[model samples]
Target: MHYVESPTSPLYSSISNTSFSSSPSGTFYFDDDEGEKSDEEEEEPDEEEKNQSLEEVDVSVLKTFLNDKLHQLGEKPQMEYPELDLIPRCRFRPSDYILIVHYVINKVLNYPLPCDWVEDAEELYNHNPELIAGSS
Candidate 1:
């Protein structure tokens, strides 16, 4: 019996890289008729499972969530800058967002970036302290 999956489920992620010929270990299978359909079938991938894809979906969700929370926290009548500055600044040449992305990629793929990456980002941040201040 083949497992029916939701098209939108992010858990399985790019099955193109997967070969169904080999049974997956620790897989969650479903019968042809199940209560809730796997994202592969429903076309609605689960939010948590989507994170496993190590695709942009997870990063975007995290970034968006951070942005929303940051903005909400920074809302004040005495605000000096627009609401946008409340979030972490990503203005340095390398940019914090880029670092965040890199970190995410490294963590997801279990790969490590060059040792200089952190130093470079820190240097850039030091050069543009205003961005960090504004974000706060």
Candidate 2:
């Protein structure tokens, strides 16, 4: 019997230039279900697999690279800035968040920045969810 995949099945990612989607292995298949219904009988792709075609990246490797880079910059950078405690603390790296808040956002707002970098907080948290999740 041919391999068939149904929606709602957990799709373990395949390797080789892995993609969030659009890779050669972007293909997702279901277990062979002879009784499975047709697409006409099924829900749309949005019905939910939660994570389909999740690219297989080694998080440990990514974490190691980040750690080494941070080491190069030294503990001074981390120590000088404040922890972003006003925000409830998601998975974002303290060092990375400080770099952006202390440098990038500070410059963007044209200095005279108050103790709070509140203006850019939402933007940072929203955009970096994936990276934060991966790092965690």
Candidate 3:
């Protein structure tokens, strides 16, 4: 990601936008190239790495267990839920059903959500002890 100083903007005179500010204070402008891919080339993996599956072994086990549980529950698991009928379906994109499947698997495994939702829940109860007791 390259930052080119616009000569027209007078705010930064000596600081060409390319020069990341060494200033140690209040307001400094820095260009953010959030999505720019760098020019560095990535090395291609060998045949062994290329043959590896996207689904991890643990994830595969979880999927199998979930499928078995769903069978026992007498509800056939579907790739897409009935709710997704409202949206234009695509072959590549996962529908609401896929999200639900993931949610259930995580729940059954007692796995916390990626961004620490369990901590947030605990914090919520801590902050509002009365609300927690009352809701239950």
Comparing 1 and 3 on lDDT, the stronger one: 3
Q: Give the TM-score of candidate 1.
A: 0.22
lDDT of 2 by residue, 72-121 (tens): 54544434225345455344344553554355334433555555223334
- Cα RMSDs of all predictions? 15.3, 19.6, 22.8
TM-score between candidate 2 and the true structure: 0.22
* lDDT per residue as tens, model 1, 14-131: 3323332111222322232434456675445556554543332344444554344334444332323343444465533333334435564456545566553233354654555654
lDDT of 3: 0.43
Best by lDDT: 3
Off by over 4 Å in 2: 1-54, 77-136
Ranking by lDDT: 3, 1, 2
Q: In angstroms, give how far residue 64 of model 1 lies from its true place.
A: 2.2
Candidate 1 residue runs with Cα over 4 Å from true position: 1-52, 75-111, 117-136
Model 1: how far is 79 from its true place, Å? 18
The C-alpha TM-scores of every prediction are 0.22, 0.22, 0.21
How would you encode candidate 3's per-residue C-alpha lDDT over 1-116 as one tens digit per residue?
22232577332242233332212222222334534677998566566555544232255544654354345445333454344444232343343335446664465446776652
